[model samples]
Target: MKKGWKLAFLGLLAINVVVVLVLLIGLLSPIKEEPLPKASPEKEAVEFHVQSNKEDLNRVIKAFIEKEKAKSFVDYNVYLRDQVELYGDIAVFSERIDYKLTFEPEALKNGNVVLRQKGIKVGKINLPVSYVLKTARDAYHFPDWVKIMPSDELIYISLDKMKLESDLRVRADRIDLKKDDIRFTFQLPIEQ
Candidate 1:
């Protein structure tokens, strides 16, 4: 019985030694962890549709003109009726002559508005369209986005070049005077 007890004690001691060795090895081993993901610098853009009517557009355009007038004095006033009309006075031989210029507005696919010269009434006098356009281009203080081409007898409004607050961009999706349907797209940037 003593010999059997000694053998049992030896067996228990060996098992205990193996368990301690395993625990020590586990404690000394290096632990590995996954690194955190980095943030991306790319930005995304969101698009929004805006709809307006002729009356509201007229008011907004008038307000914009008024704001622009503060920067520089402009004698002309633009309004949208059946057609885009420009009412202003021009200097002819040192005399101020009132003129009404009408233009047919055409919306381009690239977010631009072109005004084709439709008619001009200069105080009961007949003047060439190109001549009148050249005079207006030279006299009026137009915004940078407005380009007047005398030879082409047209005025181009670059809506894509317009700068708005908060890095927003606008595009003319549709502009129909007869149907009174005007639509625009506003592009906004989203940061990740």
Candidate 2:
């Protein structure tokens, strides 16, 4: 109630307001943006390895098949089975599929690798490549990506046209099938 007490109360209120303003400014201040560190040109070409087990490959294939299943009208039980074999630079890929027929197509050895219709077994009969392709075309239509060459007895996947991760720019140097997992060696380049 006295002048000195009133002045002291006003001083305390001013201090509180100043403290609150300082706290608000500190909390709402913009964060500084730091540029990402650039790799030197000399070390631009860096080699990296991706080691994937059988389970990982199976899981990825299953996911892809599941996505395709919705659009696909033909009934099938197609899926990848075990480890992907790598002999030299070529990778061997195989899968089991049932298209009104249950069979495990032979391991296809094209550039990328996939399952081939050449030596697919149906029950006890081993169907020819042409027959398989004809059946697939007339009876069960395949996706646009699959290119079946009945003459060459070759089945290949068109991965070159497929879009990959935008940030990662690398080419596969070599693939090695180790005892436990598959190792993929990739050569990545740094930007100038």
Candidate 3:
């Protein structure tokens, strides 16, 4: 080969080698994952009680239905009738939902209930409610910190996850549901 062509080839090869090495170094570098701040021992624990009535809950559901209607994913007609029953620390809720999918005939799904740490239970079938709730997160492009949990009769939103300023772990300790009102006792970790 000619001298000029040989020099050009060697120069390109050296550039390729340098690029590969830089990429390799970047891939091999240790990834530093920031640890969650530790909770302070002296911090005081906080408990919050939230209560809502059936009418208010229905209003929220209506608003959600309207929002979904605006999306127009599929032609749908949905009606949800929720009934709550209390069983000490556990609350059992039953819902009679009427839905029509696309152009098909209307169908009814009844006796849906919420299970602790579990998703919605539809009749004898169990559904991954998180998968359904994830659609909302994807639609609005929400962050991972925003958590949603849906049950057959109720939906739980983790408030602590929304708080970016503090690493506060929170969960529902007790749930009480009645014909008139639904109540929740949330337990929060002590912040540092």
Candidate 4:
């Protein structure tokens, strides 16, 4: 090829290489206004109950409802139809609470509640349930001898399990809890 023609061909080749390099660089750069939407965190509600009398259990539950209602939050009633065992040292109560809750603006897609009874009688203590949620919410309170882990808050809600004298005769649409240490499975939705 002649000198002038060779020079023109080389110029064309250089322009093609520059165009390809520019295209590659633009593809690698993060484009503006194309950020992904953030994912919403999930909330779970489980009811863990301990052994107690029905009347006594209802009283505290009622108070808890009123308290939540007072805060402008909707209250849900739960169904109780399970056998429980109460001993001199300990007691256990379990129930399933399922309700369509609407907390407004930020609605909770769904919640699972595990209400566990603290096995404490109210002869005259009359302590608020919210207060109890913090200090000694269960039988698994921190021992006085050693400091409990920072996350291990003192609560009387440590319901391990209780052996039963007879078979349980209740049917939970979600789960069944016999008077023994049985690990519960699945979310319970007891239609109240």
> How many steric clashes does model 4 contain?
33
Each prediction's TM-score against the native?
Answer: 0.72, 0.46, 0.29, 0.20
Per-residue alpha-carbon lDDT of model 1 for 1-192, expressed as tens digits? 999999999999999999899866644543332232222232367989999888999999988888876765446788888888989775655688889999989877776788999999999988777777876766677887787786688888877667789977777888887788889888787777
Give the distance in Å from residue 186's predicted Cα in candidate 4 to where it truly belongs: 30
* By lDDT: ranked, best first: 1, 2, 3, 4
- What is residue 79's positional error in candidate 2, in angstroms? 3.9
Clashes of each: 0, 0, 0, 33
Instruction: Please give the distance, in angstroms, between residue 145's alpha carbon in candidate 1 and its true position after superposition.
Output: 0.8
Clashing pairs in 1: none
**TM-score of predicted model 1?**
0.72
Error of 2 at 22 (Å): 86
Better of 2 and 4 by TM-score: 2
**Candidate 4 accuracy as TM-score:** 0.20
Choose the strongest candidate by lDDT: 1
Instruction: State each model's CA lDDT, in order.
Output: 0.77, 0.45, 0.39, 0.32
Q: Which has the better lDDT: candidate 2, or candidate 3? A: 2
Residue 100's lDDT in candidate 4: 18
Candidate 3 lDDT over 6-85, as tens digits, reads 99999999999998998667545443333332222323658677676656755764675566556543233232233321
Q: Which ten residues in a row have the lowest lDDT in candidate 2?
A: 83-92
Top-TM-score structure, candidate number: 1
Ranking by TM-score: 1, 2, 3, 4
